[model samples]
Target: MKYFACFLPIISPEKSQQFRPQHLEYLEKGRNEGKIFANGKFADGSGGLVIYIAESSDEVVELARQDPYVSSGARGYEIHEWEMVTKAVIPK
Candidate 1:
């Protein structure tokens, strides 16, 4: 499986706020299903970001389309497929 990081761009602030809870719920479910490796939102509160491990970009796109935020027209998003080239371990 490959990992893809999706960035949501808020389109309708009011609709986004209205569906925020459902959107979170969807993410929580994805987390439990082991589809989401890690996720978070930007500090500026513009939108959301999530990293998902899936078989292919198509799968990632499909998963993202299911998000309540998108389905409800609360927000728009962009998916960026990533290749983790290097990693450095840091003490917590």
Candidate 2:
């Protein structure tokens, strides 16, 4: 599996509050399925970052596109392959 980082730009406060619950539920679903690694909102509220694990970048992108934030127009997303040093990464 490989890691991916999905970035979402600042969303309107109404949208953020409207979608936050479903968004977090989606993350929990991914976590249960072992597809999610980590996630967080920016301190400055610029956006959110979600980390995913998948076999290919395309898979990660597809997953990112499905996020409630993106699907509901609460946000748009950009995804890139990611790599972490040391023990944070599982052995391939």
Candidate 3:
């Protein structure tokens, strides 16, 4: 599997909030299935990011399309392959 970064720009903050529950559930499922590496929204509130583990861009795109935020039209998305040459350390 490879990493794909999904850029999700908020189209409607209201809609995003409306569907946030389902979207969180979807992310949780993906996490349990090992399809998602990490996901969160931008602090600036412009958008969100999801790192997915998949075979190809096409595969990731298909998976992303199922996100409640995308399916409910609360957000728009683009998929790109990500190369992780480094990791950030989170200090305790």
Candidate 4:
């Protein structure tokens, strides 16, 4: 499995607001299914981003397509594959 990051731009705020409830529901389902690794919105509210792990880009794209926000034309999403070379963890 590979990890991909999806950036979503809210094109139609009104439409996005309308679809947000369903969108959140789908996100919860995706998270439960382990398709979503992590996700959040920008502090500025311009858009949002989601990190997902999937078998292929096609799968990621399909997931994005099914998002109500995107399907309803409330947002546009761009997907990018990520390559994590190294990581370090710090104890709090």
Residue-pair clashes per candidate = 0, 0, 0, 0
Q: Which ten residues in a row are the worst by lDDT in model 1? A: 83-92
User: Which scores greater on lDDT, model 3 or model 4?
Assistant: 3
Sort by TM-score, top down from the best: 3, 4, 1, 2
lDDT (Cα, tens digit) per residue for candidate 3, span 12-88 = 99999999999999999999998999999999999999999998889898899999999999999988899977678
Which tens-of-lDDT digit does each residue in 1-92 have in candidate 1?
89898998899999998998998999999989989887888889898899998999999999999999989888887998888665777223
Q: What's the C-alpha lDDT at position 47 in model 2?
A: 90
Q: Which prediction has the highest TM-score against the true structure?
A: 3
Q: Report RMSD (Å) for each prediction in the order shown.
A: 2.7, 2.5, 2.7, 2.8
Every model's TM-score: 0.89, 0.88, 0.92, 0.90
Which candidate number has the best lDDT?
3
- Candidate 3 residues lying further than 4 Å off, grouped into runs, are 87-92
Residue 64 alpha-carbon offset, candidate 2, angstroms = 0.9
Model 2 C-alpha lDDT per residue in residues 1-92, reported as the tens digit of each score:
89888898965767877998999999999988999988899998889899899999889878987888888888878888888677555633
Quick one: how many clashes does candidate 4 have?
0
| 1-92: candidate 4 lDDT, tens digit per residue | 99999999999999989999998998899989988987899999998998888999999999999999999999999999998565666222
